[model samples]
Target: MARRATVYQVAERAGVSIATVSYTFRQPQRVRPETRELVLQAARALGYVPSGNARGLAKGRSQVLGLYAFDMFLPCDLSAPEVGLDDLVAQELDRLGDVRRFPLYVDEIQRGFELEARRLGRSVMLGSGTSRDSLGSIDLAGSVDGLAIFPGGAARDLLEHVGRGVPVVIFSSPPMHDPLHHITVANESAVRELVDHLVEQHGHRSLAFLGELAAPDIGARFTGFQGALAAHGLPVPEEPFDSTVLTEDSLRTLRAAIASGDVPDALVCATDQLALTVVDLLARHGLRVPEDVAVTGFDGIIAGRLSDPTLTTVRQPFVSMGRLAVRILTDTARGLAHPTSYVLPTRLVIGRSCGCS
Candidate 1:
C-alpha cells in the first residue's frame, strides 16, 4: 500500500507553516483568503486529507457530537411471522418488509440531529447501548465534543460518570436531581389534555394507565394522569399497570383483565407501541375499541397513524427536540450560555381509538 499524504507535506508544498494549514481546515476564517486558497490547492494536489483525530488533539475539542440511543438501530426480525399475530400485526410486518426498514421514535430524532449538526458544520457519531451492558461499551467520551443520550436503558451512574467530563444532554427522559442538561417533551400537559379529553368529552369515569414505572417518561406521564383525574374530581387509580413494550406478557395481562372483567373504561398507554398491541389483544379477546374500551397512547409514532382505528396520541416535537439538543450540545461545548433543561410542547391528536369520530 502507498503512504497516505499528511498535512506536513501540504504545508511544505504551500510554503506555509503547519499551523496555517491547520487553520485553513479547522478555522478558515482566521486565515487569509489567499493563504487559505493556496493551502487548499496544495492539499488537493497532494491528495491530503486532514486527520480529525489530530485536529481534535490539537484543539482540545472534537468537531463531532455523539448521539447514544438504546437499541435504536437494531434490525427488525422479519424471518418468520410469530404465532398468534393478528392481521393488523402481520400487515404491519409485511409493510416493514416491503420497505425493508422500520424506524422508531429515536430514529426520527436522529434525523433532526443529523440535519442540524450538518448545517452547523459538525458531524454526529451514532452509538447504541443495551440494558445488559453500560454505555461505556460505545467508548465515545474522548471522541466527541459532547453527547446526547436517550437515557432509558442507560444506568444513572454511567450517565453521571460520562457527564463529569463531557457536556451531556439527556433527551426524552424525566428531570434528574443531577445538574446534567435535559430536553424533554411536555409530558404532564399532553397527558392531562389526553385524559381530560377522555373524561370530559367521552364521559370516561374509570381509566387505567398502562406503562412501566421504571421508565422516567412513563412516571412523568403517570403523574400527569393523576393530576388530570384530581383536576376533574375523579378518583385516582391505585397504580398503573406495570408494562413495558408490547410483548407476549403484556398480551397475557390484557387477556387476564378481559377474562376477569376488570377492564377499565379507557386504557391510556404510555407509548403508541403498547397501545397498538393492546388494541390488537383486546380485539382478539372480542372487545371492540372505543365502543367497549377507549384507548389512547403517547408518542405519535407512524405505526399509530397506520393502525386500524388510528391511535389517539400526544405528538411530541421530536424533530424540534433533536435540533434543540444539537444546538444545546454545541453551545455548551463552545462555552456559550444554554438552558440546563428544555421542555418542548406536545400536541394531543384525537383519533378513532379515543372515541372520536
Candidate 2:
C-alpha cells in the first residue's frame, strides 16, 4: 500500500524547515514567495496535503473556513447503494420548486466567500442543515477555524450559540446577534430609494410590497415600502399579502388579487425571485407589466436581467459581502478584538420592468 505523504517529507524535499512548510500552507503571506513556491512544488510532487486536524492540534487553528447554510444544499440521496428513479425525481423537484434556493444570492455569496478564503491561504468547507436538524451547525462549528452562515430565523439560537465559541459571520440578516459579526447591505435605505423612484418619477400611486416580514431583510424592505407610501400621501397597508411569509397562503392571496383584476399600481417585491413570481402570475392573468402594473425587485440577481421586462431593482453587493465576511472571520480568529458589524452599500438599477426603458 502506498503511504500518505507527510509534511516532513515535503519539508525535507523542499530543503526548508518544518515551520516553513507549515507557514507555507497556514500563513503563506508570512513566507517568502520563492520559498512558498518551492514548498508547494514539493507538496505537489509528493501528493502532500496539509492535515486540518494536525494543524489545529499544533497551531490551535484549522486553516479551513466553513460556509454554513440553511437547507440550501441538496444532492441526490445516495445513502442507498443506488438512488432509484423515484428518489431522483423527487430530489430534482425539491431543488427546482424552492424559489431563490440556489444559483442566486446564496451562490453569489458563496463564490465571494470561496474567493476570499483562497486569498487568505485557507480552504472552505460548505455545511448545510435541514429544518429537522439543529445540530448540523454544532458539528460544523467544531471543525472549522471560522464560519460564515446564511441567515434564517430558525437558526437564530444556533447562530448565537456558535458565535460564542468560533468567529462567526452572519449574512443578510439583522444584527440581532450583536456578539456575532454581520456582512449585510443597506436594506432599508436601498428599498426606500427604489420605492421613492417608483412614486416620484414613474408616478406609481398604489404600491404594494410583495413579500413577508418574517425575514429581517425582507422586513426592512417592507418598512421602506411603508415609508415611501406615507411620504407620497398614499394609504399604507397595515399588513402585506395577509401579513405572512412566502408560503402557499400568501401566494394564494396574490393569485386572488390578480384574478379580481384590482391589483395595485405597482408591486415592490422583497426579492428578485418574488418579482419573477409576480411577473409570471400577472402574465397568467392576462396583465401586462408596467403598462398595467409596474413591478420592481430588490436583489439584482442574474434572473432579473433576463426577465421579460428586465427587472428594475436594487443590487446588493453579494460578492463583496462574502469577501468581507472572510476578512472578519479570519481577523477575529487571530485574537484581534471582535470586528465591528458592516453595512455595505446597494445600487438602484433602472430597467425595463419599471417602465424606465
Candidate 3:
C-alpha cells in the first residue's frame, strides 16, 4: 500500500503556511476564498483528507451530533465492533419484512436528522442500546457536541446525566415532569380519533386494543382506546390483548381466540409494525381484513400504503420530529436558543384496512 499524505505535504503543495491549511478547512470564512480553494485543490491532488478529530480538537467542537436510541438489542455477533457500522440508515434497507423488528420509524426520522445535519455542516453518529449496557451511549456522548436520545428505561437518567455537560433531546417517551428537553407526539388524541372513526362511522361493536403495555406510548394509546369506548357506551376490556407482533405464543393465542369466536370486529394496534404482522397472521387463518375484521395501526410507515387493503392509521410527523430535535441541539450548541420540550402532532390517515371505503 502507498503511504498516506500528511498535512505538511498539503501545506507545502498549497504554497501556504501550516496554520493556513488548518484554517482553510476548519474556518474557511476566516481565510481568503482563493487560499481555501488552493488548499482544497492541493488536497485533491495529493489524495489528502484532513482529520475531523484533529480539527474538532483545535476548534473545541466535535462538529458531530449523536443519536442514541433506547430499547434496541442486537444479536451476539452483531454487537462486535468490527462487524458493522452503527448507523440506522444503512441497516434499514433490508428490514422492511421483519415486522417485529422492522426499522421504519427510526429510519425515517434519522433521514431527516441526517439531512439537516449535513445541511448545517455537521456529522451524525447513530447508535442503539439497552439499559443493561451504557458504554455505547457514553462513548457516543464523548464524541458529540450534542445528543438526541429515545426515552425509555434507564435512558431518562442517562439523558439527564448527558444534559449536564451538553445539549440533549429525548423523543417518544412519557411526558416528563422535569424541565429536560424532550419531543413527544399526540399519541392519545391520535388513537382516540382513529377509534372514534371505527365506532361512529363503522358501527363496530367490538374493538380491542392490541399491544404490550410496557411501553409508555402504548399505554397512552390504550388509554385513548378506553376513552373512545366509554364515549360510545360500549364495554371496554380491562386491559389490552398483550400481543402486538406475530410471535409464536401471540399467534397461538390469537388462533385460539379465532377458534373460540372471541375475535373482535377490529384490532387497534399500537404500532404499524404490530398491525402489519397481525394482518399476515390473520390471513394464515383465512380472516380478511376490514371484512371479517378491521385493523388500524399507529405510525404511518410507508409499507402500510402497500398492504392488501391500505392501512388506516395515524401518521406521526417523524421527519419533522427528527429535524426539530437536531435544530434544538444545534441551536443550543451555538447559544442561539434554550433547550425546551415540545409535543408534536399526528394525523389520522383514511384507508381501506379500517373498514372505510
Candidate 4:
C-alpha cells in the first residue's frame, strides 16, 4: 500500500514552507493568492486531501457549528381517542409531512441554520438533549467552533458547563446574566398583539390562556396575555389551563373544562401545536370554532395554515433566527462584536380561527 501524501510533501513541491501549506488550507486569507494557487496545484498533483482533524488542530477551529435542542425530535403523542378527521385538517397535516415526522419548530430552525452555515463555509452538528443525563453527557467542547442551544431541556449547570469552553447562543429563551449570548423572539409583544386582536377586534372578553406558566417562553406569553387583558380592563382568569405539551392529559383537561361549562369565549394557546390539538379536541366535543369559541396560537407553523378554520398566529421568524444564530456564533469565533442578546420581531397572521376575515 502507498503511503498517503503529507503537508510536508505539498510544501516541498510548491517551494513553500510547511506553515504556508497549513495556512493555505486553514486560513487562506493570510496567504497570498499566488502562493495559495501554487499550494492547491501541488496538492492536486499529489492527490493530497486535507484531514479535518489535522486542519482543526492547525487552525484551532473545527469549522463546524453545534445545534442542541431538548425536544427537537420528540415524537408526537398520538394516544388521543381517534375522532373523525376533518378533510382540511387531514390535508394540512399531509402537506406538512415533515412536521409530523419531526418537531416543527426545531426542524424549521435547523433548515435556516443549515442554509446560513453553508454560505459561511461551515457545517452544522445537530443533537437533542431532552434530560439532564442526556444534556450533561454530550461532549461538545472540542468538537465544534461554536454552539447554538435551545436551552429548554438543559439546566443552568449543564449550560454553564458546556458554555464555559465555547461560545454559545441560546434560542427561544430569555437572556441570562451569564456570558452566553441569546437570540429569542419577541414573545411578550407578539402575544400582546395577538391578545389585543382578540379583545379589540372580536370583543372576546372571556378568554383563557392555556400553557405551562412555569416554562420560560410560556411564562413570557402568559405575561403578555395578562398585560393585554389588563389593558382592556379585564380580569385575569382564576386559573390557566396548564399543560407543557399537547398530550392526552391536555385533552382530558380541556374536556373537563368543557364538561363543567367553563369554556371561554377564546382559547389562547402558547404554541401552534397546542392550538392544533385544541381545535381538534373542540371539534370532537361539537364546539364550532370562531363561532361558539374563538382560538388563537403562537408560532405560525404549517399545520396552522391548513386547519379547517386556519389558525390565527404570530409567525415567528424561525429561519431568520437560525441564520442570526449562525452569524452571531461565527462572529464570536472570528473575534468580532456580536450582540449579547437579540429579540427578533414577529408578525401577526390573521386567519379564520381568530374570527378575522
- In model 1, the runs with Cα more than 4 Å from the true position are 1-5, 8-47, 71-101, 135-138
Which ten contiguous residues of candidate 4 have the minimum total lDDT? 72-81
**Candidate 4: lDDT of 311?**
92
| Candidate 2 per-residue C-alpha lDDT over 1-357 given as tens digits, one digit per residue, 9 for 90 to 100 | 799999889999999999999999888999999999999999999999888788797789888899988744423221235579999788778777343445788899999999999999999998877655778887888899998888665556677788888988888876663688877788888988998899889988888887867777888888877887788799988878535344444477767787787788888888887788788778888898979999899889988887788999999999998888898889888978755578889999998898887
lDDT of each: 0.83, 0.82, 0.82, 0.83
- The regions of model 4 sitting more than 4 angstroms off are 1-49, 77-103, 134-138
Count of backbone clashes for each model? Answer: 0, 0, 0, 0
The local lDDT score (0 to 100) that residue 131 gets in candidate 4 is 54
lDDT tens digits by residue: candidate 4, 1-357: 788999999999999999999889888999999999999999999999888868787678889899887655434433334556696478557766544334488778989999999999998887765656553325765588888987776777777777778888888878778888988888998999999899889988888888776558778888888888888999976457655565545556678888987898999999888887788888888898989899999888887887779999999999998999999999998899987888899999999998887
Q: Which runs in model 3 stand beyond 4 Å of their true positions?
A: 1-20, 27-47, 72-103, 152-154, 244-246
Best by TM-score: 1
TM-scores for all predictions = 0.83, 0.80, 0.83, 0.81
lDDT of 3 at 58: 87
Candidate 3 lowest-lDDT run of ten: 72-81
User: What alpha-carbon RMSD in Å does predicted model 3 have with respect to the real structure?
Assistant: 4.8
**Per-residue accuracy of model 3 over 223-286 as CA lDDT, tens digit each:** 9889888888999788886554434456555677888978989988888877887898889888
